[model samples]
Target: MATSRLGFSFLLSLFLAVACSTVARQLRFVTVIYRHGDRSPIKAYPKDPYQESDWPQGFGQLSQVGMMQHWELGQALRTRYSGFLNKSYDRQEAYIRSTDCDRTLMSAEANLAGLYPPEGSQLFNPNISWQPVPVHTVPESQDRLLKFPLLNCPRYQQLQRETRQSAEYVNKTRENANFMAMVANETGIQNISLESVWSVYDTLFCEQSHNLTLPPWVSPNVLQRLKDLKDFSFRFLFGIHRQVEKGRLQGGVLLGQILKNISEAANTSRPQRLKLITYSAHDTTVVALQMALNVYNGKQTPYASCHMFELYEEDSGNFSVEMYFRNESGKEPFPVALPDCPQRCPLQDFLLKTQSVISQEWDHDCQVPSTSQDTEVIIALAVCGSILFLLVILLLTVLFRLQAQPTGYRHVSDEGEDQP
Candidate 1:
């Protein structure tokens, strides 16, 4: 009887362990891309009262509110990933990257402060609670990863031109003609198309967020219209037409990097120690990424919004990816499902589905057909070839005539000698 009771307890303990292991999936890797916190307007319209001098740090700088926003977001991230991440900052286990903009860099620092406050041995100074963490960045002109609407891409520019000519774009333009004219007149911007209108909206939005009194022309209804147009512009730039090709040129650049990281994490044979990677970027970065995933909701990404990718390894050794978007403060991030993929999408399927947008050679892909330089080169070559052909023809004709004349003259001389 004693032996049977002991055996039963042992079996029960083994069963519970197996059950717990099966119920909990092992989170192997985490990738997070977040928009920078609140910022001053990038630029003001010509007629606006506020100029670069009005902002505390001039145009496009991060404000103090932006700093606090990132700090809160960092704390939230810390809480959510407390179990998965290290208690203190570990350079070996985590990497952080930001765009080379002041706002994004500052936001990354603020977030790091909240995410990894100094603890124990890491505490350098008694007065300060934060420890420095490295944030990597490349210059904006060269940064193809985080910057959206890559202006240097001629093919992307051609696509934009095509998008502007699309029926939907035309219809939107016609419908908003009067409103656009009003904005143009009031803002002193003569060419207020969909592309340039967003700047006006951004300046107003930033000013309102900071409790500045807007002009009478910018009524609540007008502001709402501007916001709607701004959202539409986001969709227009990324998704209006030839979306797949545009994705290949724009957002796919960043997506390819992300998928590569996930692949490395999923590799069991050659495992990487890094568990978390974070990108501090702008709202446009968020839109570009979501657009590539075919999951953008057509709403402007808010300040400090975070898009997270969590990779998990199941008990059966299969790996999966789950996505979450944390747009609002004080709320749980909502799950984002890839189009035609399950909520917990298998790693292979995710990669296979996204392969179409992943450009193997981004620079080569951005090349436009019949570029002006190419056309000029072709024309120059054709002109030079024609000139060379004409010169050869002229030389050949002159040689033939010279040979014929010499033969006739020699025959005449021989006849004259015989007569003598």
Candidate 2:
């Protein structure tokens, strides 16, 4: 009976240990990247009647619906991570970054209002439900580090040119040539191209979403094609010829920064003060980050869509990273998978997979010399030579004319004149 009792106690102990080990996953850190909420179209097509005045806040400014969209997203985040975050606002616990655009800035502010509503004595104002939270940003002009679809990278521009020249791109263009031509003719938009079609779609999409009547030219099929082209344009922007290199210069810069933050958060010796960091920017930003992680679904991320990176530390001191994207306001954020890894990938493996795309010198890689550089130099030298040739001809003409004419002081002998 004593032996049986000892055996039962040992079995119970083993079962308890197994159960504890199974439930030991702890969330260490979180990073979120989200597109700014809805807004008026940045610009309109030639035939578009909806002017800036049509929008309540004018063009490119966030609408009231946009504010509510972000506010709700913030509340969802609050509920999702309530266990990990503080009950009240904590400055050291969270950091927020946004692009220097007014829409994105306002969106961040709105999001923070929902994420951290003051409680207890923290509420200074009784009527207002919002409190101020610091949002950090660098000037858009100098912000190559965080911005996506980075416009200043010369190498990236070169890649775009190459991609356009690729046979696949050309073939796709050919396939859509008839459709694009029809769109241009029917819409009365002059000089329309595949690249600029997205703007047209955006305007129409915004109008439709806001319940404005669309032009007769914009049929269901037309809308679908517009969306397809827009998705293709985005893919062509970051992919096509040398996708990995393009990602490194554009998305990978931002990814590198995010990785550094996660790495710091994972360091157990540190205070772990920063539990969350949120980036509020554009749809392009969300797509670029996902593309860099090899998880893009080739669809345009909806407005106010969010991509979340979660870090978990197991009991054995191993850390893993998981990614989720909340594209729809109604549904839960879905898990995203990394290439050749599980949905919840080990942190070390995540870093290793992304090692190739991590840019060492962003400015250097972005300025990578191409054959076009030589072409530019040649063109410049040719221009200089042409100018020099013109100057030389002018000088020769002046000298010849001077020699042909008599000087101000001339001798009486006309045939062989000499200065007195």
Candidate 3:
């Protein structure tokens, strides 16, 4: 009886030890890339919500509500990673970044409010809102100047064009054509292009949210249709078309940057367990990065949706990366699982899994331009296009006025009008 009891106790201790070790194994390193929370409109369309004058926070600015959303996210993250990073603030073990947009920069700050608070040696003031943490970023236009995603390779542009002409794109064009025809018939508006539809949605969504008055024609049904258009436009930017090349443009390059940071951190023996990189940008920015990594479906995810990727190194020197998505109203983050990966994932597996991308039309050797050069191009194009567009609009307005003149002024041919 004594021998049996000893054996059972030994077995129980062994089980507990294994369990503890496994738990510790998971609490090693973590990396997260998330989208910023809700914000004011980036720009106004012909019929969009609260204009620059109407928005208290101004265009593309994060509001108080946005702050709350990020704060909640920070709280959730704090709980989830409390075991891995720390229960409280640890400056030596964490970093944060934003995408250099007003909303994103503010979002990072708000998130940090929940991420780090007074604890041990990390607290600076007792009654402060929170300790200050660095949320690094460059000029918004110069974000691409940092290197990885900033290649100016001609081959990449070629691949982008190829993707644009692919079977998927052709199908999308067909779908758009049908949808446009239907909409034109319904609204009695001819030539309803993507731009027109997108403008309609942006105006409605922004206006309605900020309590700005909608246009006379902006009914519920029309508003819904406009939203659908926006989703389709996002898919065009992300899933159906530009994902692989975009991944090559952004995440593929950023992945390299992240690896470099990790390698340096490991070599230097730094304890930055929470590499809390932040990106401050628009919805398209989120879509571009997500789709390139083959993650987003060809649909709109939502406002303030977040994507998190966690890296773990096992006791045996094996590395793993787990992915999770937190939309606004979820009880728990959804696992972004793959066929080969379960909940607790591997990094190398992620690289390998996303390697194929979605389509077969991507070029591996595209070079992204420096951020300055790209920004310069955008500025030049915008200036020239603005001038041209104004001229076109003015000319069209005049032409329309002329055509709309009374028919009585136009000479009527009185050939055989028998006054029926």
Evaluate all candidate structures by whole-model CA lDDT and list the values in order.
0.93, 0.88, 0.65
TM per candidate:
0.86, 0.86, 0.70
Tens-digit per-residue lDDT, 123-205, candidate 3: 67767768777888887556652222333556555455666678966676677787667656654555767546675566457
Q: Write the per-residue lDDT of candidate 2 for residues 142-221, one digit (tens) a residue.
A: 78766778888788888888898999889988999899888888767887777888888898889998999998878999
In candidate 1, list every pair of residues with a backbone clash. none
In terms of lDDT, the poorest run of 10 residues in model 2 is 410-419
Least lDDT summed over 10 consecutive residues: which range in candidate 1? Answer: 406-415
Evaluate residue 208 in candidate 3 and report its C-alpha lDDT on the 0 to 100 scale.
77
Stretches > 4 Å off in candidate 1: 1-18, 370-420
State which candidate, 2 or 3, has the greater lDDT: 2
Candidate 1 lDDT score at position 164: 90
After TM-score superposition, the amount by which residue 51's alpha carbon in candidate 2 deviates from its true location, in angstroms, is 1.2
lDDT-based ranking: 1, 2, 3
Q: What does candidate 2 score on TM?
A: 0.86
